[model samples]
Target: MRIILIGFMGVGKTVVGKSLAKNLSIKFIDMDNEIEKRENKIISDIFKESGEEYFRKLENDLLKELVKQDNIIISTGGGIITKQENIDILKQERKVVFLDANVWTIQKNVSKEINKRPLLKQSENIAETIDNLLKKRINKYNDTYNIKIDINDKNINEVVSEILVHIG
Candidate 1:
């Protein structure tokens, strides 16, 4: 089985994906991490130097490759839905799960790792920024996901278990 987790940043896609992969005894791939590994630079650095267009192209290319593999769980970056080609690719998948969370939940989750995020650095009010982004992306997420999981009140295990139940 191949499962792809998609949502806004700080929605716990990576954490939930890892647990799901572990329980299913499959490999877990964080798309951003994979891109960082391949480029030998962090995502923020990629955005800073090469720019977001470059990063998005790299992401698109990687998505094309990863979808061909089996027995893996892919946790995609938040902005993957921004590109039409990427959205098309995700729509083709059988198990694309959108892990949904509220603005306050997202702010709390991302605060610890704010330094790692490039987009958040562009904003002064994190909550308002997050809300705006969510508004823009929520429709795309709704259209792409086969399963929608509200992750606002769930732990990693709970999220994973819920995914397992749905995907099973």
Candidate 2:
């Protein structure tokens, strides 16, 4: 079984995916981390040096490679849904789980790790940025998910458990 976790950054895709992979006894592949490994640079640096378009193209190429494996759980980047091609590649034979978090929840979660997120790097108003970005990607998320799990106010353990129950 291949499961792909999709959502905005700081929505606990990495955390939940790790736990879920352990629970399911599958290998866990963090897309962003693999990208950094392959590119020899952090995601923020990729965005800074190469630009979003280049990073997105790289991410899509990597996603195509990652999805072909079996018995793995993938934690995808937040903006992966920006391109329909990414969505199509992700949904080919994987269960795409949308770890839904509202704008306010996203702000709260992202504020703690704002330094790591390239998109929110210079936003003075993180809440507004998250809200606006969510508005742009919400439809894309809705369009390609196999299941949706609202993770607002939920801890990482709880989120993993919820995904397990939903997927099973």
Candidate 3:
């Protein structure tokens, strides 16, 4: 079985996916890392040099390739759900889990990170941007996911346990 974790930037997809995959004895793949390896460039560089449209196309292609793998836990980028084709491919081939977290939780988590997120870098009002983006993507997330886990105040183990329970 393939499991795909989808959510905003700071929602712990990578952390939780790694733990979950370890526990389940499945291979774990971070889509962003996969993209970086494939393109031989950082995501920020891709956005800066090639633009978001190009990045999105590359993300879509990566998603297609990822869904074809078996017994893998895949953590997707924040903007992956924006494309209907990506959503369709994920829903058709994997157990899609939406890692839901509030704006404050996301902000706190990301604030400590050194890596730059393209969307958050452009925003002066980070909270507002997060809120608006979450609102806009909520329905798409809802439609594509088989399970939605509330990630607020939850540790990686708790989140992984909840996902395993839901998937079973």
Candidate 4:
């Protein structure tokens, strides 16, 4: 089975995904890294050069290709669930886990990397951006995720434990 981790940029998807994959003895793939590798450019660069529309198209295509693999753990991009088609494609044959954290927590965790995120980089206020974006996408995240793990008061290990419990 493919265990897909979905959430905003700062919710520890990549770190948790790596730990979970190791614990489960499966390959772990971060969709954003995969895109950067394939395009030979960082995600921020992709957004700067080609625009988010183009990058989302690449992300959509990659997700379709990735679900064909077996026993993989996927850490999806923050906006992966923004499109209905993408959500439908993932739900076809995958277990999607949403990692939950408030906008304040997200901003705190992602402050160092805010420059790396295309959408947040354009915002005049990062906290406000995170809040607004989360408000807009929370419903979609809830609708698409099969399992939800609230990591607000949890460490990485704790978060992984919760995910394992739910997955099993």
**Residue pairs with backbone overlap in model 3:** none
Give one digit per residue, the lDDT tens place, for model 2 in 103-137. Answer: 88888877777889998989988888888898999
Residue 85 lDDT in model 3?
Answer: 89
Arranged by TM-score, best first: 1, 4, 2, 3
Question: Which tens-of-lDDT digit does each residue in 79-139 have in candidate 4?
Answer: 9988888989867754899999998889889988877888888899899899889999999
Q: Please give the CA lDDT of all the candidate structures.
A: 0.95, 0.89, 0.90, 0.91
Q: Which stretches of candidate 1 lie over 4 Å from their true place?
A: none
For every candidate, C-alpha RMSD to the true structure in Å? 0.6, 1.1, 1.2, 0.9
- True-structure Cα RMSD, model 4: 0.9
Winner by lDDT: 1
Cα lDDT for residue 50, candidate 1: 100
* Residue 34 C-alpha lDDT in model 2: 94
Better candidate by lDDT, 1 or 3: 1
The local lDDT score (0 to 100) that residue 49 gets in candidate 1 is: 100
Clashing pairs in 1: none
What does the lDDT come to for candidate 3?
0.90
Per-model TM against the reference = 0.98, 0.96, 0.95, 0.97
Order the candidate numbers by lDDT, best to worst.
Answer: 1, 4, 3, 2
